[model samples]
Every structure is written in structure tokens, then in C-alpha cells.
Target: MILAETLLFALALIDCGAILFLLIYYIITLSDLECDYLNAQECCEKLNYWLLPKYIAHSFITFLLLFHGQILLFMLNLPMFIWTTFEYFTVPRGNLGAYDPTEINNRGQLKKHLRDVMIYIGYYLIFFFIYLYSFILALLKGDPIRRGSDDDIVTEI
Candidate 1:
């Protein structure tokens, strides 16, 4: 059980680390105030490539959590899941309509943004529930209770 707990903690740490890294990367991408239309497209493409490793890491962590039944491991996996879901929706993808802006005007852009927002929000909700379910299961198991205590039991007269 101790070994299992340690492994679960390690996996969770890795998972959280990956999420922090990805969050930093996203922040860096957004920090560039000069990011324009083309820049946004390029950033999105680059992000897509970068996300592959993160996806794999997340999947691996989830696998460990499920197989090991480590609540800590599942807890570690939750942030990455949430962040990725958020990223998927918020990351700007080019317009779905014709590449040319002339064909798709303000209304089209608004619609596209709305669609992306909805998709992201929906997915986030789904993943959130999944994480919550796993977390609750883990919590129910409770932490490994320590075996020994030094306290003395006294009888009152």
C-alpha cells in the first residue's frame, strides 16, 4: 500500500508538472501583443504539435491511475485534463469557412467563436465530471492510516 501510494503520488506530480509546463507555454504564446491573424494561425498550428506529447503524458498518467487504483494518481491527472480541455476550446483555429475573410464576415467570425466556446465549455464540463468521479472514489478509500501511536490511555477515577 505504501508503494502504491508513493507511485500514485509520483504520477500525480508528473501530471501536474506537465500541466504547469503547458500552461506556461500557452501564456508565453499569448504574451506576444503583436499576435495578429496570421500569427494566431501559426500559433495554433504550433500548439497542436506541442500538445501531442502532453496528450501522451496525460494518457499514460490516466492509465497508471486506473490500473493502480491510486486516488493520488487520478488527482494528479485532473489538472492536465482540465487544462487541455480548456486549451482545445480557447486556442484560436482559423475560420471554418472560406480562408478568405471577404467570404466570411463579422457574423461568421462571431459564430465561429461562439461554436469554439461552446465546444470547449462542453468538453471541460465532461472532463470535470470524470475527474470528480475518480477523485471521490479515491477519497473514499482514505489515506493509509499510520499503525502506531505513542499516546497513553488513562482511566479517570
Candidate 2:
């Protein structure tokens, strides 16, 4: 139980930190996106839908952990694992907020979009295991094990 909880907490914190970084990166990219083929509005909407929710969901899960909301934690994490599974396949198809495929007319553009999709998906995929481990720990724990423990939490300067 201790090891599992330790791993769960560590990974969850790491994932949340990485998510914050990603949110910043996505915001920078959205503003800096070349507006030749992709509409900036569309890119913003995609960020709102995809990247923003990731930040929210990850943060909410961390809150759930801090307060020891086991049931809610399990519930929220289950769907995310499932969603990540699907994203593993769909992301390669320009389905990950890259411009629509039909919009790309030439080979160079197609390659560039594919490379973009791969980079986004590749970096993001590392966190899927964190989510997976969390879901499993929450499921197995079945109740709050760390409900009263605040000793492990670290405060920044």
C-alpha cells in the first residue's frame, strides 16, 4: 500500500507539473501558429477543448488527492485512461487539433502536419502511464488511504 501510494502520488504530481508546462506551450503555439493554412480561431478552440481540459482535469485530480477524495479520483481517472487509449490511435490522423487533413493539398504540408502530430502525441503519451497507474491505485485502494496524511506534500518557496 505504501509503495503503491508513493508511486501514485509521485507520478500524479509529475504529470500535473508537465501538464502546466504543456498548457504554457500550447498557449505559446496557439498565438504563434502560422496562419497560412490553419485558422487561429480554430486553433484556439482546439486548445480550449483539448489542452485546457487536460490542465483542468489534472489539477482537479491533484485536488482530489490532497483532500483524499478516493471515489471521485477513481471516477475521473477512469475516463481519462480510456480517452488516452483512443488518442493513441486517432492522434496520428491529424485528429489532435492539427488542421483538418483535407486542408493540406501538398506533400510537404502533409509531412509537416504528420511531424507536428507525432511530436505532440509523442511528448504527451508519457503521462498516460501516470494516469493509468493512478487509476489502478485509486481502484485498488477503494477508499482514502492518505485521507489524513499531509506530511508528504511539499510547499514551494
Candidate 2 CA-lDDT value: 0.53
Residues forming the 10-long window of minimal summed lDDT in candidate 2: 96-105
Per-residue accuracy of model 2 over 1-157 as CA lDDT, tens digit each: 3245656566675675566566565545544555344564555455436644564555555455545545565565555545544543354454434344344434565446445545545544545565667657656776544454666653432
Give each model a TM-score.
Answer: 0.44, 0.36
Count clashing residue pairs per candidate.
0, 0
lDDT of 1 by residue, 90-121 (tens): 64455432222332234564345335435544
What is the overall TM-score of model 2 with all chains considered together? 0.36
Which residue runs does candidate 1 get wrong by more than 4 Å?
1-3, 33-38, 71-157
lDDT of each: 0.51, 0.53
User: In angstroms, what RMSD does candidate 1 have relative to the true structure?
Assistant: 8.9
